[model samples]
Target chain A: MRKSIAIDMDNVIVDIETNWINWYEKEFGVKIEREELLGKPEDEAFPDPAAALSLIYKTGFFRHAPIIEGAQEALLKLQEHYDIFIVSAAMEFPNSLPEKYDWLNEHFPFISWKNIVFCGDKRIIDTDYLIDDHLKNLDFCKGTPILFTASHNVNVTKHKRVNNWNEALALLGLH
Target chain B: MRKSIAIDMDNVIVDIETNWINWYEKEFGVKIEREELLGKPEDEAFPDPAAALSLIYKTGFFRHAPIIEGAQEALLKLQEHYDIFIVSAAMEFPNSLPEKYDWLNEHFPFISWKNIVFCGDKRIIDTDYLIDDHLKNLDFCKGTPILFTASHNVNVTKHKRVNNWNEALALLGLH
Candidate 1:
């Protein structure tokens, strides 16, 4: 069986969180409170964090997101070996799942929409490389977690911190 | 027979002109002469429009391009009836085509590198609905040319203008 890879859409595929944070915060009437969202346990993070993720995604903020530095190059290298699955927790919220799916279809056509899984909790899904930024979701990975660095992560430094797609590839030993 | 629709990438798929105007004025010391670029014949309006387009596309400008307002809804709807080809004159220039294609893949996965048609003059390709912003390329299509609206083209009333995608659907009768 081939190793499957789970990649996050927001901060990893593109810089959605950083760029849309201000606009979304203004519109939603609440702060993202990155530390709190990432620090909470998965059970507590549910509904609120997922709600926040879906809320931001519903505003159509990720439509024009800039791809993370070296994202395409990194994905290209990764695609050669592993089964690239863009399993996004971004669109798991209600009312906008289909819209987010359409958006995903527009951005990345290489993976069939079938491979693009959406769920509130990522730990339930199994994959080889879980490339994501949130700490709450990283705990359930049966495989190694490739941590994507962001502005709002806690001080737990056990996992690999990748600055860009290039660093991600290097950490995966694909470079 | 499938009616091939060869659309432009820069403005057709995403708004590349507005993004470049800002870059050109600051870096190249050239204010965007839109009237000069679109109105006059390509030879007269843009003595080196091809070169200029190549320069902008190479700068990774396509990575952040907003899908042209009408083109987005229009392209998705259009994808159903015809074999849509992204025939961009911008990527025909040297050293920029690969990155430009990659950029398209990042934003609009519906358009793969293989389906994209590159030409100095779109007149060479065969297509029905040539949804384009540039007037020069419109000459290539024997079918109806659905004009995507833009800032520089506020005054050109000769061609049909579409600000939203639904109007594009109506124009192509894809609705």
Candidate 2:
């Protein structure tokens, strides 16, 4: 049986840190060092985090978000060995649904629509492995949790961590 | 607190029974009366159920599927009193994701994208009420199950059956 892998989209496959930081800096007119966000929840990393995060809920943010370095290549390689599902807590931003779908279609065309899951809660997902950037999602996963490194999650140490796509591929034995 | 109602998409909202019957006749060149399909799972209703059902997996079938009579009106009215979520087993048909999303956008624009759940298994859903045509979905639901009468499920007597949208509205005291 092919092992199934449920991958989170925002910080895992897509590079939200770079885009968010740039957007936040330009929008807020405040310089935010990347390290300032380390080990902090996104809301706590900045003043008025709700307003800052709401920018992501806008129409074009997710559609134009940059793909993390090596994510496309690693995911394509991973698809050959496992059932790769792009699971995201997209309901938080209702507009992200079509944007995320279009983003995946553009960047990860090889992934079938069946493998894409847009849901609110991660606890409901049952898979062989879950790769997520948030501890909240990983904490409830029924499968082995591989923490994908993100600025907000760097301090989390409960699960095995993958700093980059190469590390993820190696950990999954895809390397 | 507004009660959450998770509504199934296929027969409960979109009229798949009529569309499937029409498509089955054109593709298979065999007339299948609606009554003949009663009480039978979709696949078992035909000689080559796999092939018959595969037609539904095609691109246009779901996008072009007609809405169940009164579903739109009923849902609009229900939205006034309850939190409505459109939950469908869309992952089973890979091609239906975008189609279903677009269909909802066109027909049920009042429903926010946050309420749309495209998932494989319905067991994970947490809601107050589940309105679905499939007994398999309702059997595992954590809430009151309202069986929406579909041709395949007309014989089902296990749950509170609502034969039409008017009946459904009346049962929920929305009428």
Q: Give DockQ for candidates 1 onward, in order.
A: 0.01, 0.25
Question: Candidate 2 at B26: error in angstroms?
Answer: 21
Identify the candidate with maximal TM-score: 2
Residues A1-175, model 1: lDDT tens digits: 5687888877788676554555546656666555554655433543355555554545456555566778777777788888777765542333334444556556665665445654445544456778888877777675688888765554568687887887888887788
lDDT of 2 by residue, B65-106 (tens): 899999999999999999888988886775677788889989
TM-score of chain B of each: 0.71, 0.96
Collision pairs in model 1: none
Write the residue-wise lDDT of candidate 2 on A1-175 in tens digits: 7898899998998988777877887888877788888888887787668867877866688888899999999999999899888888886765666788789889999887757778766765667899999888899897899999999888787999999999999999988
lDDT of 2 at A122: 70
Q: Positional deviation of B158 in candidate 2, in angstroms?
A: 15
Candidate 1 residue runs with Cα over 4 Å from true position = A22-58, B1-175
Give me candidate 2's TM-score against the actual structure: 0.65
Clashing pairs in 2: none
lDDT of 2 at A112: 77
C-alpha RMSD by candidate, in order: 14.9, 6.7
